[model samples]
Target: MFTYVMRFLFCLLTILPLSLYAAVGDHFYYADWYYEILSETDMTVANLGARSASTPGLVYPTVEHNNKVYTVIELRKESFSSSYTFKNVDFTNYAPSSYKIKKIGDDVFNGTAIDPNTIPPCIEEIGARNFADRNDITSVTLPSQLRILGSSCFQSCANLQSVKGNFHLKKIGDGAFFMCQKLKTVELSYSVEDIGNDAFVSCSALESLIMPSAKTLGTGAFQDCPKLTSISLPSNLVSIGESAFLYCTGLKSIVIPENVISIGKRAFEHCDKAEYILFKPATEPAYVNWKGEAANFTDCFNADIESKMYVPSRKTYEHGIEMISFEDKPLTYTGLSPEISWKNNTPWPITVDTSNLPKTAGEHNVTLTAAFQNPSISLNIPYTFNIVKAPLKVTVNNSERVYGSFDQNYSCSFEGFVNGESESTVKLDLSYVTEANYQSPVGTYPISATLTPANYEPEVISGTITITKAQSTLEIQNLDELSNLKTGEGVIICWISNAPHSELSLGSETTASVELQKMSTLTNGEEAIQYRLIPINPGEGKVGLYASGSHNHEDAYTEFEVKIEDKAGITNVHTDCVSLITRPYEAIIIGKADNAKARLYDINGRLIHNGIDNVIRVAKRGVYILIVNNSRYEVAL
Candidate 1:
């Protein structure tokens, strides 16, 4: 009779609705419910009541039946109709093979346990561990009240693509979410503090991740995630576990924060695409076990040629002076004789083998050896030096010249040399050669010239030119007003001179030579001489006489005019206004009308002036005339 009653109670419990179960405290305690309800297959709705003071929310417990133990599958809320009809569950079923329970309104439902026949017999406890490895799951939404994820909770969910919730989670267990190949994005709760080993490993499609509050990363946590391009680590993180980012080829660069103190071996090993590792420390960190032997943090990059480490310190292993120069000249031995220095400031004997240094102007490498004073320890350092050509020198010579009576040509030359070798003469360039008006002045004047060589600065030289007045003098004599003469008549004139010989010319005729003859002294004890002047044509002109000698003697000149009467009959002669003025340097003549043929003469009958125009230019101031046709009009200038 007791067995029958117990069987009836069990059968009645299985058929009753899940909301009829009373809540214990605030959260629904699955263990306090009847065993028949926990073993039901269709109890799809459950109510967790209000949050518990001790457990906060719904609590999963281990249930013992017969000689077997069953673990809690999952606890979640459920929707309901107005009349209390069971509605759908709210939590996502990421693991389809695992059973789930729900809280409908305030009532809790204990759904069916997973089929024992389908689960492997070796797995004794089937709950979080089994749910994590289920094959049918594709997506999941973790409960917000969950604080810690047990180990292997989501391992090997190959098709799992997305995960949401976990707003209050603090820690993720080892092997959680491992090998979820299709999983792409994850948004971690801000309160998460730790990630265990192999978490998210081999999640090839997982591209984005954010763990702002996580302080610890376990070994192989993010390894083999090829599509994971970027992640933001917590600012307070201090250490990284081994193989944390192994084979994460999409990660390009990472910055180690200042508070980080150590990194495990192979933390970034096989990250082929990572190019930069920036450290905030000014010097090397204290504990870096990345590589076994050298154990530098950079070694985890697997000797990638493009990968580099940036340190803020200026410290280096080398100590020496570097030389540079624009001129390609040989370096002296005295300049490079200083002993080699070590960072520890150890005194060592040094020797530099500069004999192999090339003499040609260019950069060269030399060997330097440093030996300990005890002669047991020695080191060799390779040094580089540069040699360039030396500067050039240029010089120009000054010049001087004496003035001559006529224009003349003069030249000045310069010399230049580069590196003590004379340059080609063709490269010499001079600004100018001759000085202008060299024959006109009788005082000192400045003369200058510039010389330029191909590779040297230009040089300019200036000199003085000196000129002196001539010494010889001459004077004219005989009657003052010597005037008319017949066409073929000759007139006598005299002259005085102190030169060797005197030359005479009539108009543009060929010169006539006159030899100086000795005579008695005159008024000022000056030598006196005489000569004859003649007129051979019926025209007005002048006879000019000049005394010539060497440059040491001053030249002398004198002139006189003569007129010859015209025997031809007058043709177009007319009386017209005529004017003339004669200064010591020049004479001017003007006529009232144009196109009048005029001839001018001095006391001598030489035709000194002839012009067909109204104005005529003459040399000396004297008495002259304008003879048009056969009429003669006298004028004084």
Candidate 2:
């Protein structure tokens, strides 16, 4: 009840003074009444050696004998000299005597309450806009009782470096100390929640800043001050306004807490020197809509660092292996003269799993990471492991294509490449084991290619070889089925064409059987016909066609279906069986026997392919399959 009554009486007193002034037809003039008195008063008239006389009723109207100025009138014309006496305003008996006096201008007083020696007749407040536009004032000491520094109180005080005191301040008004250029270091006290736009802008020399209690950096607050280097932002700070640090170039690195949602454009513009902005790892997978994958910010930012040279340690000439992984076996290094320093940030002697590398032969690149106290200089040492085991290489010499026919012959070979400087060799060991429903070149074949340089490890430096039995196709042709002919009268059953190292032993009729021969007209698709006959006998009851065209261990075989027909079937075979005249294009059989030796010939009796064929390119247009020696196949081209 007492508190409410006191507050009511205080409100009435404030309204009564304002009402009385308004009713008297006077505009409410908010000015320093004490300042006006201090400005124009003569405190000591008796001590003056009067060079300039104060004319009565001219300079000021002295009323009531106290020398108080109720109004000002035009001064009577009098010449004033430099030696005229000046009076200092005396406030010896004032209510607040020991206020923390902050001198803003030559005679302007922007002060806060001091330890009062006496009780005040009225509530004393900081004068309205009292400290306005005082750029010359760099240092200030506020009173503990200071409640407010009104709007624009310290606006545009560019040199104002330090502001101290004022424990009770609740708000700092708008545009307060807008461009305090020399004001680099600021100690913001409690309860300052809101700072207006353009506050504390253009303080270029600011090097270090710590905003422990700041809630936000207002719009354009620190724009265009290029010399700022580091800032310690509060984790609880919510938002930093647009263009807040737009042109601050000396800053090197920064971290944006997850709490900050948006960073305005041009807010970090022209800040090219800054490298690697750290951010909290995303809890949810953050996908890049443009890249269609989870963004590897580390890789992307590192690439940017490399291209722009923003990070001092990202220079291109710096040599370092990136990352190496061990799989299947611990990677072994040979002839490493300088002791290899196990790198990466992991605890020393950490064993990484290496059970995924190819058991046979291949090349792989691995990566690892290490932490260093000095990141800039540590990049010169690789954070990855590099080792070159005996490089394993597998080569299919024309490894892409091969084929064979029943009662035919074929050949196949293998080769390899070395991936490092190791002197290991891979020797081929063959075995004759038939499985998987077919007879194949089965063996525990071990092959490898060792690097010759003994220490250098190239990325793709190994090659190897494996020879296997070729797959064969089936073709049956006879002259008796097409033309009316007798089997006893010599009906040329041209079977064997150019079976590399194959043979056929006639089964029951070895005396009168199909022979191995070369037909001349069948080579180039020429209509005119000729034949080169090579006598052959089907040995025993089965005509076994064996192929030995491949490497020494890659020989194979295929059996042809036997046909026993009457004499009338032989003449019909000429007309219906093999249409040599109608076969489109010509067939050229260019193939290798043992030791990779081969030959090529056209239907026009021309050698197009050599024994050691370096480059063989076949263009099969409208080519018929050439059933050569009832074994291999040559497409008519």
Candidate 3:
């Protein structure tokens, strides 16, 4: 038992050191060991094989024994890894003098040398013509200061899922990211100015893109991106290169801006899924070069992808005006034509038909027909012409006299005025009189008339006629008893006659006046005349009347004596005082009566007040009068 124990102890001692040495050496092959054992494990390590160790979450270079480098090969942490390795060396501290690459996670990488000076002499950009076929990277966050992405950068990176941090980038070189089948999202910066030829071509997983600041697009810029459903081109873009958007089948519609002057060959060809192409040029008759050929257009529109051309109509001549009169010349219209086309080819010649035009002077509508050689292709256009008319002139003959007791007839004449001169006489009709009344008493009457002329509307006119009464005898009676009149008093002289008088003349032999108070014809055909005789001064006067008729009726004359007296004790005077009856509130004295000492009394004969200065003011409403110098003057209020 003792001999077997000694042999087993010796063999165990030798194999234990060898196993520890092999375990330590496995960390030296960090990349191989990581893929073999810890590729799927979740852990963090700062320094794997270096002289000095780094902090737990910070990655930096540290020299250790033997001047060797180490990094984390595959860290499957929840947030981010601190350090990583490529080919078993740490490249987190690499500068432009010594360019290197390192993978920090499953498909994530970091690079330190990003500017142009850090790149090789033959390469114009940091990643130009490099890494075209790399398929392992799933996401890349580039440096913030990267200005340009060179030709074919990251092209054919089939597994590249996303790219971030291109904030200061200015241009994207030719074929950059071309055929990156798995690339899903890439946000370009606003500082970017141009997109080079074939950029982003065949990026089938890219759904939406925005290039807000780019002004020019090179040839085939977005060709063959079938999964690209939407793209926002810059508003200030000026031109598009050949085949720029070929085979972009996912686009629904597009509007070409007016600022873009040229579009290259096949730029929008094979875009079969696009429903419309809205080409908005700046002006009419725009010239567009398509497929190396030029075409003129007034407006470019395609509703459903079927090509249709619009050709504007041209006016040949202006329409003439026609005069309105019986002796006017016949009117003829000519020279109305329009250019017509279909599918960019002229198919017909236009002809205007004015045969159905009316002979009247007014606006007339004419029909224009685009009659082609083929009857199936025809269109109609409606046109118009203007016609004028001369004004009408009317004159009526005045009658010397017309008896009011008999019916009468009259007429008016009309003429057409041309160049301020009468051309021909126009016929007038009596039935066109709108208003005519001649049965009234003798007076002047107006006649309202309107007439219609050929090819014109109704014309209005005005006329007048004088009417006179028939011959009749005029006589006055019952005025011989108007003799006793008082000073400042009025007497009414009345008379009856068998004929109505149009006027009457009155005269006085003394300083007295007479005024006609009322004159009216009674219902029995007899006339009544009344005159108010005012005895202004105390004297005897004669009031005469001369009645005259409207026509040839004989006039009659009559006279009466008016003795105006100033009686000192005249009582029970009538209420016909001229000044007192006219102005009932004021008191007035007769001729040569001064310092009269008047007294006022109401209609009931009751004394109310006294007056001075031969003037009285009655304060209440009633019939009152004044008695001056024992003479009573009655006033009716």
Better of 1 and 2 by lDDT: 1
The 0-to-1 C-alpha lDDT of every candidate, in the order given, reads 0.45, 0.35, 0.44
Whose lDDT is higher: candidate 2's or candidate 3's?
Answer: 3
Off by over 4 Å in 1: 1-130, 281-283, 286-294, 305-307, 314-637
- Residue 272 of model 2: what lDDT? 56
Give stretches of model 3 more than 4 Å off: 1-91, 94-125, 280-637
TM-score per candidate, chains pooled: 0.33, 0.30, 0.31
What lDDT tens digits, residue by residue, belong to model 1 across residues 263-374? 6677877777766554543334443553423355445556652225543222321111211111234443222232322232222243333344455434666544433343
Best by lDDT: 1
RMSD of 2: 22.9
- The local lDDT score (0 to 100) that residue 634 gets in candidate 3 is 25
lDDT, candidate 1, at 412: 51
lDDT of 2 by residue, 364-463 (tens): 3432222233221111111233455443343222211122212212122322233332223433332222111212121223232322332232232222
What order do candidates take by lDDT, descending? 1, 3, 2
Q: Which ten residues in a row have the lowest lDDT in candidate 3?
A: 317-326
